[model samples]
Target: MVRKKLYRSKKKLGQAPGSVVYTGERPKEKLFLEAFDFTKDTYTEKQLTNIEDCFEYKHTETVTWINLNGLNHVNAIETLGKHFDIHHLALEDIVNISHRPKLDDHDSYLFLVLKMLYYNNSHNLVSEQVSFILGKNYVFSFQEAEGDVFNPIRDRIKNAKGRIRSMASDYLLYTLIDAIVDHYFNVIEVLGDKIEDLETDVFTNKSSDNLSIRIQDLKREILRVRRAVFPLREVISKIVKNETNLIQNQTSTYFKDIYDHLTQITENIELHREIIGGLMSMYLTSISNKMNEVMKVLTIMASIFIPLTFIAGVYGMNFKYMPELEFKYGYFAIWGLMVIVFLVLLFYFKRKKWL
Candidate 1:
């Protein structure tokens, strides 16, 4: 039920463009850096204690993947950007986590922003902005937190199980992007499950007091997922059609595969939107129908009692000169007549299926 705010801080409101401002909340955990340098014949992985420790990997002939966990540290981001010759604007976008998925192609490198999505321990969807700087021999990745969906890619690199060790840095970039896009399927599947549960509750009349609230929450979640995912289509499209040296010709094919995945993901997102809309309408309709049935039963009971009340009211009238009052069988005959009337009405109602 939490709606994420756009700007966590106003520190960058009046600041100039290309200003490196960390707009997100500061984490208690310190900044962490992990470096993976690998080639066809050799592979090495290290956990660096300081940002300066990773500066040497820039000049290495082998492909390097430098991942930084904490974005709340502005000094470390500025220093890293300065050391790598990354554009000031790119660094600004990196610190601004609210920025959507996009691509900035430079002559020397390509800067890309993407949303990494996954479910947390509580099964709530969590999104983190992941920015990547793809250079000739190194790929620099900046993230908001530590855990991500790239563990499979990491295992592949560590075990040297695939062509990742043999491919160039461009192919490595493709693999990284592919990993993120693959996790989108998992998120979308969770959305589909939610839609099914909503449908079940609506159809089976098993709705709870908070059913509507849950539906609204699901709607907001869909919006979040869409916001995180939809724009990536353009980002991938740019990479596929990009003419930069950072993205090689062979790797363009692999990026196209990512494009296809995005297309499928967007289609599923739209489908989920429609289904959620239908569920809201169905829930409302079910509630309305339930009320109508209750009203119908009450109306039928009132119809059956009106005539009986009229008979009782007529006989209860005071009349001292009334001849029926003097007759001995008058009370019994009146009782018989009332019972007949009641039976006849009951039979008629049963024939009409009013009961």
Candidate 2:
């Protein structure tokens, strides 16, 4: 029997902020705040401790990006929400952790939620939720954990080599979303390599219990990837279609580019799924062919032995008047005849190609 290694565990769905359950000494969730303040030639970054301190930096002419790592601090989130005039529901969804990938326009702000994925050491798929609130001057991001897959974007911003950081918050949001989508390509590429390796092994070697388990795991991972990416297409489409002042017209082109990448990733995922399905069919066919060969060999051996066994049984019957028993050479002649019969049957089977 195969064992399942990855599954979702049950947990409290909705808990109120400040409830003992929320404050109970769960490991202190790391909250990393990285600020990128940039305008054409000038770029500055700071690690902020409190969201309130960000209010001064919000209205600056320079585009500012405030990235908040952990959302466990309800007080900080509420303060940030109030400072930015973010809607209550958006704040609620920001910390919900289970919110689906989506985009919403709040007139003054654009709220976006996306799922970030990575393969762990065990080759199991893992995902985290990322929430973004884009306003006129500043952009705020909330993640479930501290570390991000966005380190490259940070490096680009720091080097001041790219227009990404100097661009408006909308462009920063685009870069961030683009970076996440790019990681999908990396993940799916790894999955494609795995499928290729498994295909080679399936054809060259017999299928084992592990093969089925690995196929199922790959299928599940692809499904998970699809779930994460499919909704993003709609999210980006909405950004492109809706004429939001928050997302500049020029930046809309970048969002369209992201949409294209999402489409490519979706196609790649579909192809991978088809390949896995083919591998599964091959596995079944191989098992059936092996079983058929075993049955054929067994039938041929049984056919040759049945008549020989009957002949021996007849000679073994006890009878005082048996003529063959009275002849001295009869025993030797019987053995010689049996040998001839066995040789003829073997020759016939060989000629028929049944051997």
Best by lDDT: 1
Candidate 1 lDDT for residue 201: 87
Could you give candidate 1's per-residue lDDT for residues 1-355 as a string of tens digits?
2233535546677899999988776656579999999999899999999989989988889999999999988789899989989899999999898889998888899899999998999999888899999999999899887898889999999999879999999998898889999999999999999989888888999979999999999999899999988899998888889667788788899899999999999999999999999999999998998899899789877777788788778877897787778889988988888888888888987899877
Off by over 4 Å in 2: 1-27, 120-124, 319-321
Which residue runs of candidate 1 sit more than 4 Å off their true CA positions? 1-11, 316-339
Candidate 1 lDDT score relative to the true structure: 0.89
User: Evaluated with TM-score, which candidate comes out highest?
Assistant: 1
Model 2 has a clash total of: 0
Per-model lDDT? 0.89, 0.81
How well is each residue in 256-309 modelled by candidate 2, as lDDT tens digits?
A: 999999999999999999999999899888888889889989988888888788
How far residue 109's Cα lies from its native spot in candidate 2, in Å, is 0.8
Candidates' TM-scores? 0.91, 0.88
| lDDT at residue 246 of model 1 (Cα atoms) | 84
